[model samples]
Target: MISSANILFEFICFVMALCFLKGNDKFTLFTKLYLGLVCITETSGFLWMMCTNKSNIWIFNIYILFEALYISFGLYHFIKPFKKNVKPLYIATYLIFIAVYLYGSFTRGFFKFQTTAIMVASVLIVFLCLYYYHNLMKSDKIISIRNNLGFWWVAAVLFFYFGSTVYNLFMNVIFSNKPFAYEILVYIMLTLNAILYGIWSYSFICSSRHQKLLTSSY
Candidate 1:
């Protein structure tokens, strides 16, 4: 039930991104593509599970690689307007994450989740989101917070990733507790996904409204 709701949330967010964010700019286009990939990857995971009756970890393993890259780039896109010299920071983080992820994949095999790599990526993302907030607060652009698409989008990412930090860090311990802990984690994931996609949908709407205002002013 909860899993289905998360899937529904994913689809809804993807549709919203398509309708509101498509073709606006390079970042928006990349966002649209990323959301599309999310939908496809999710659907493929379910189908793979149904057919093989086995773990589809490999699908998500590959997905996370792109997820990290796209999200890092998205943060960089938003942050570059304020800080010109941040490219190396973003690039270096990606390099570290890719190396960690590859090591996890090779050592544990693709069938296992790369928990360490995920933790690293999630922690880094949370920090980047904080950095974004820090810059936004210090900038003269404070008045645009209400309809700032990038702000809202990054907020959603922060909430989702930060909220999942506990689960990501304690996956083995949680699973070791058997059905109860597992069920708890499932609910946690459902809530996290809701927060993520819910805010993403709203951010798309905000972007649409902002664009309309700009168009009308001309």
Candidate 2:
């Protein structure tokens, strides 16, 4: 269900998607489309849970599929230019993530959380983001971090996934044992969503300014 914290996160993402319409970077637009899908899924889940008063696990089960795909693709898009040799590895990791997702969905069924898939995807994406950072630090050319959209975007992913590692680990345990853990989960989610969407929104704005600067230069 939609919480007060996540609504702001979704709004920022939506506003940033509209901002992307002004820029020429198709890759940025691609991420924006993914963001749109995320918002749609989240809203639908909220409405489903609220209206029916039933679990919306299935909705999120389906969402995790697209989440892995889009984030992997986005990572590939960001890292491809910098690390050619890692191209095959990125594709392989994405395929592996899909395999894991399918396995979890079919075996565990959609009525429950895709815990295994989420955990695996989280660890894999963190590694990918770490690899990107390593390459960025090693690059011969000097660049200001302020101008690096990819850095901010990847950092957002890293922060969210890495921070959620513990939450993912204890997700089932908390729900089963701690009756009042919803508040804790809400704040954790709030922090994660804020960090993820906040950095992404800033990155889009940077991309916009970059487009303008390049056009002015030309």
Candidate 3:
């Protein structure tokens, strides 16, 4: 169960939090909080499993609530400069996600994985990422995405949730019965986690660089 990809994800999240703590990104506070939560949840979930030898599904079910809120709020923050009117949509969607999660918890029970809620959350995040891109392009900005921390952040969300989604859709039918399939799926998820955190870590670095540039200019 312990693997390099898991190690990599944890390492990246830890480092990203460090970068955000010292950096002066406009959203540095939010960045640090989110990354710190990411690390904490991951560590706590692992330790709880090892200590009790119990299923971690319940923990993740709760984690998804915070996950959805944090991501939706973050997107709302990012998109504020472009469209103020659209901000309410994010708030409404976040409330919907919470409602959906509540429904899932009641219907599926805490012990089971709520794939429907997860899929809904994932779909919303992926859609937000696409919406951000569409707005980014519409803005006529000439800057490369590399310098845009928001772009990288959105991209990370896009890739991880989108990749996991395909698995979410057919995993029970295709991979549940096979012996090694679950293990392979776990690794695939780890890789996706790595991608999300790795890009996020770099985005923090980019934010730090820009923060320094602004300070030096002043």
Candidate 4:
């Protein structure tokens, strides 16, 4: 019987396929790039875990590097649609994250530092999203669009992603001896991530439609 993690991985792959087929045109070029990276990282991580039983530590290390890169780029693009100057800062942060990931991968003692960095980045991204939502809420031009979809979608994604990270961190630090418990936590996180991506794809679709309508009206 396929485990829940396997099932969730399959579902994530299926959703990614559907997103490529149906929502490719809706996403911005940056969004597309980040999404592609995310798909690669996520699938590889899942496969590595399932096949190697955490023995292939290098794969997990690479996965973490790629995931941080993906998140940094994703946030960059997500905000660039409104805040352009922030791109450079995001790039700088990404480089720092990459360095940290590399160090952590090579040195077991540094793993805790990497986890802390990831948590900090995640929190910063959530704050950025909230700031964007606040500005959009006050803007009259696209108030309806922002209110109806953008803000909520961003909030949902941040909530799940951050929540999962917290749980995984706890499992890693506090329940290190319980392998099965750690596996379950990872499975839950993967499922939440897949759901978050689906919501992100839908939000891209909505944003595309709204933009087209606005252009046509003008």
Candidate 5:
């Protein structure tokens, strides 16, 4: 099942964050926290489904709120190094997300999947990822992408959301028209999760090595 693989990946990322990144920086601390929440949410959702044989949409509905906010904050953290006066943009992004989320919740109900809200969020995140890349390219400072945890982390985010855009956009159509739709969707999700968690695990390794080097140099 997707949850089995997803939970394993999330647990690995969470452990790496704790061992290598906890207290390393504000961003990493938050990342660790976020990963912990992800693990818990995924497990809980899985258990809820197994035990109650009911939809866990409400759990994900709540989790998505945290997910969007944390991702926005992460992007803001990365982008702030290159651009000043970005707080307003960050705030504006939250406002837009909240507006959409509330509207979706009202229209679709809290227990529904809220596809429209997620779609809006995915689009916003993709654009923000592009903006971050643009700023990264324009900056004068030389960066070592190999050891840059932020770069790799953002790259994972970019790949997952941007890569999933088409799938997300036509998810209903695919389910309606395609054979083995559930299997196809699961495979897609697994691939996306592998990409995301693989990069994240590597970033944590880079963070650990980078920290060790920093310590040795001091």
Candidate 6:
């Protein structure tokens, strides 16, 4: 039987492919790219884990690296169309995260150090998201698109990502020695991730539909 992680990884990849194929607009295109990269990296990690009999620490390490890169790219695309000045800061931050992950992976045990880094990173990301939203609101740039879908989508992503991050940290720190418990929680987290991705995909569709309607009315 295929592992749960493998199954979910395949499903995510399939969904990402469909999103890419159907995406015609720039917004959808960026979303497709972001999700596609995430799915690819995750699937690769899972495959590596299975092939190596779940003993290869490097797979998870590389997975975290890809994840950090994905977030960096997603944030870049998210702010690029509206606020170009933030691009350099985002790039710098991305490089810092890559360096940190590489250092931790090579010097420390992959899962343990990766978990610690992710927990810290998640908190920082949440703060950044809040800052972005606050600035947009203050500038009176919180128009219909920003109000209706953009803010909510960002919130959803942050919520789910952080939620999963917290669970991962807990599994690593609290249940590290309990293999069965750790495995169960990991599966649960994977399911949550799938649900989060589904919600994100739905939000993308809604945003696309809204734009199409506005275009038609013009």
Estimate TM-scores for all models.
0.95, 0.92, 0.89, 0.68, 0.94, 0.75
Q: How would you order the candidates by TM-score, starting with the best? A: 1, 5, 2, 3, 6, 4
lDDT of 5 by residue, 1-218 (tens): 78999999889988887887744567887898899999999999999999999999899999998899888899999899999988787778878988999998998799877777888888899899899999999999898887888898889999999888876877767656775676777788788988988898888888778778788999
For model 3, how many clashes? Answer: 0
- Per-model CA lDDT versus the true structure: 0.87, 0.81, 0.77, 0.58, 0.86, 0.61
Query: Model 6 over residues 19-46: C-alpha lDDT tens digits?
Result: 4234465555655665666666666766
lDDT tens per residue, model 2, 124-205: 9999999888888888867667766788889889999999987898788888898598678767878888889988888777
Q: Tens-digit lDDT track for model 3 on 12-40?
A: 77676575536455466666676677667
Q: Report lDDT (Cα) of residue 141, candidate 1.
A: 60
| Candidate ranking (lDDT, best to worst) | 1, 5, 2, 3, 6, 4
Tens digit per residue, CA lDDT, model 4, 1-218: 22455455445644544453333443345455555555565467657778877644454455566566655665665566566598786777777666655666577553243565566556656666666676666555555654234554576557765676667477556556766677667567666765675666556556656666667999
Poorest 10 consecutive residues by lDDT, candidate 3: 19-28
Cα lDDT, model 5, residue 103: 96
Regions more than 4 Å wrong, model 6? 1-30, 80-84, 109-113, 145-149
**Highest TM-score scorer:** 1
Estimate, for each residue in 1-218, the C-alpha lDDT of model 1 and write its tens digit: 66467679999999999888844578988888898898899888888988999988889999998999998998999899989999998998799899999898889888888898999999999999999889988988644766678989999999999999888977867766655678888788889988998998998898888888888999
Name the TM-score of candidate 3: 0.89
Model 4, stretches more than 4 Å misplaced? 1-27, 45-57, 81-84, 109-114, 138-140, 146-153, 211-218
RMSD of each: 1.4, 1.8, 2.3, 4.4, 1.6, 3.7
